[model samples]
Target: MDDVTDRLAQLERDDEELVLDHFDRRDAWELGHRLAHVALERALPVVVDVRTPAGILFHASLPGATADNDEWVNRKSRTALRFEASTALLGTRAEHVGFDFFDQGWLDPADYTVAGGAVPVRVAGVGVVAVATVSGLTSADDHQLVVDALREIMAN
Candidate 1:
């Protein structure tokens, strides 16, 4: 964990390990519900989302969340699903490598963000097929919730 990579390497490991055999709308619903339930237990204000490239499969907004969180969900989810990695990894890369995605001019801030919270849902053979995202908490916290939930669900 202390490779001096600014937490980037561990996040990359998470992406490497959190792979699925298959994912569908039912899986998304289960994941969304699990995330919501945990958020409730922690009294977290957040929006959880699960979606594929075509459309969203599941979404939930906890009480303290707002439309702004929804926007974060959209941006973070898009970034993760598009890049096939966790948003946190992107953010860390930006910090360590001085790579400003916004300055690159390839990614529009309106559609994508490197902030933590969204994680790409990768299938064993198919690669990334969707994304699971949380918004409203601090970026790291938001990212952790989704990662932890995915870890539990995958474990079971």
Candidate 2:
């Protein structure tokens, strides 16, 4: 398969896995720390956030992250939760459809955005109950950071 196709497939797998994985406050803390650790190791300046449908569980802003990054995180998280899909996937789909998400979908541009970095946090047989988000990198890179951290968290 082509690189783009392969990347999409991997993202699909990751979305499914992350959705099925069980999580609670403890898990949220662990996952958040793990994300931060990796970002620090890579020297990536970013903001990480984890939240349940009901409330936020964790949030952090690393070096170089800005208030604007926090706004993007909110927008991206809303997109993922509303659609029950990763923002990265949504971004890709929007590009394929010629950027019609706002006009065609009847969603307000101010409230929701299909940018990358936000992913639905779900549990097996429970469906999506939270959102995990990172911002400050390219869309693909931000999405991959969360996916990679979740993969590592689930493997252990």
Candidate 3:
């Protein structure tokens, strides 16, 4: 948890706008949908996951998002659990640790492509509590959509 916090803090320092105002499951879902729609509009597949106190609260797969992408979401969720970090961070950390979190096990068998496009949603100062991710596009583009969606959602 400290590691997660430190990383988030670093991100906040690097980009003050990265700080989130916090949100609940409903808001997360709405934001996730917005992100999914954006990815779909670009003809890129997207997958969204909203974690809640009761468990995962919502999931959506846009057109062109493959079954493998769904599986990668699951894997990312699991990895998030293991690391006590956001799925996005977990994927990044995995790469730093010399393992491609998105290319192992079921992910490799599927059309899973992991590079970017995952974000952790947090309730202000509470740390990461959910994740929104997209696939089927360049990792950079996927990540940009997630970031843009969050910015839009938070601005509203």
Give the alpha carbon lDDT tens digit for every residue of 6-100 in model 1.
48888878978999888888889999999999999989989999999899999999999999999999999989988888999889988877789
lDDT of 3 at 31: 80
Local accuracy by lDDT, each model: 0.90, 0.85, 0.61
Of 1 and 2, the candidate ahead on lDDT is 1
* Candidate number achieving the greatest TM-score relative to the actual structure: 1
Tens-digit per-residue lDDT, 62-135, candidate 3: 77678877776665555444444444444555555677644546454233333455566655677667666666
* Model 1 misplaced regions, further than 4 Å: 1-6
Candidate 2 residue-wise lDDT, 91-120, digit = tens: 776665467788875888888888789988
The TM-score between candidate 2 and the true structure equals 0.90
Clashing pairs in 1: none
* Model 3, backbone clash pairs (residues 3+ apart or across chains), number: 2
How many pairs collide in each candidate, listed in order? 0, 0, 2
- TM-score, one value per model: 0.94, 0.90, 0.66
RMSD of 1: 1.5
Error of 2 at 87 (Å): 0.4
